[model samples]
Target: MASFQNINIETQIPEEILIAQIMQLHESISKLESLRPCKQVNSLFTRLVKLCTLPSSIDIEALPQEVKEMRDSLINLSGHAEGLLEFEFSTFISLTPEPFKNVTLFPYYGNYVKLAHMENKILKENGMVNAKKVAFVGSGPMPLTSIIMATHHMESTHFDNFDIDEKANEVARKIVASDAALEKRMKFVTQDIMEVRERLGQYDCIFLAALVGMNREAKVKILGHIRKYMKEGGILLVRSAKGSRAFLYPILEEPDMVNFEVLTIFHPTNDVINSVVLLRKPKA
Candidate 1:
């Protein structure tokens, strides 16, 4: 009955109980993929998510060396498990010669559907309902975001998906290869966003995936590349996390986008794990 409803956001979670719960969650999730369609992932995080919703009060800056090290290790394991789950599902779908027919069966496919609606709502509010060309950096092996957006939201827009892994791009390409409509609108590029040093001013919108930079330092570096190439006044959508969700995904901070004007910030209180940050590149 370790409950956090009465806990103050400013106070730390009981250290011993926190550590033990994390250990249990870690041990259980270690045997399973992080994002399984089963109840396993949800059951594991149900209680933890409650506590994590308001951010862990554990002050990483004030922690003892041993406690901090242990926390980092457990968090890394949790994050790695999540990445594996996405890869696992993507691999399964890729094996199906024509993945699009059954791609919606993806365990977390509904997440992207809701996410698409959220992004569309945001874009409409910002008067960017009809983007001509879009780029999704770190589109991953599945490319769910681009797939959902291209197929449903911006049906007329061209989507260019970028991934550093050639194999991932290959899989993503196959997912949309059978659909002539998608094939005509979506293109997968096997390249890192940082290497595309030329001014990427042609894109009307750009999306930065959660896994693009798993760490703060890496995220900062990638943002620099984006700022340099992103069209002046273009829109950039970033996926991030808040509170204990940081254990699975990197949290975006204001410092990361000092040059860009952040327009909106959203963190779903429901099962949706990602927080959305909308930003606009300032014209010099």
Candidate 2:
């Protein structure tokens, strides 16, 4: 047998470091195995990265200092997979929605809570059931959350639900129709938010859960139009899938006295999905 070059066992890492690296590798293997191919959604890669690399509350930058010795043994995980797109390369991925098995509103969560927590927070704070008016934009399945929350105490509030998607509008109508408490208080409409400027400021409070994707320019234009319907100090509730202070800053900087406040953040444990961001438009 050929004599092997003298190996320096002393240079080897400690056992704990080796174990941590192995654990991280196992996590990555599980994630890759669990990933399914789906084409309908745009954020698939970002979702995959989150699922593969992060825990619900992981601090991405600092590996537990205790485990740092094994750093070289593990892959350095990035926050989201889209980070890989800076280079001109393409990779394929897939996603599909399985039937959601467990559904209920609890302190932990259900789809409704994912959708409604923002509006509920505001209503509880303002004690605004007596307030004359309220509006909802994009009254999808989630608007029911707001309607149900409003029904709890508001006796004489006018609720308007608006949507441009026929499918969404139809679904909202059925949900609203079934609710006796909400029937007198709520109305559903199929219309674009931009086209309804004439009725702006007609409500004391407005709820917006519209999808304002990556297009910051469009959001700015829309906010400018929203100024018309809001009363001098009425509140505008906003929830979106995308949250960037930089994108929001331009609209908020407009000459109008309208102010923005963060209501609450309802981030889901599902990393492959976007967290919900809630905001308020202040009259001051």
Model 2 superposed RMSD (Cα): 13.2
146-233 per-residue lDDT for model 2 (tens digits): 5555654455778888877665555445545555666677877788888897686788767655343123356656665776556766
Q: Per-residue lDDT for 5-49 in model 1, tens only?
A: 566766666755665666566667666644544566766755555
How big is the positional error of residue 152 in model 2, measured in Å on the Cα after superposition?
3.7
Report the CA-based lDDT of candidate 1 relative to the real structure.
0.76
Clashing pairs in 1: none
**Residue pairs that clash (backbone atoms under 3 angstroms), model 2:** 37-94, 37-95, 38-94, 38-95, 47-272, 200-229, 201-229, 201-230, 233-283
Error of 1 at 32 (Å): 9.2
Model 1: residue 124 alpha-carbon error in angstroms: 1.6
- Among the numbered candidates, top lDDT falls to 1
Among these predicted structures, which one has the highest TM-score? Answer: 1
Q: What would the TM-scores of all predictions be?
A: 0.82, 0.50
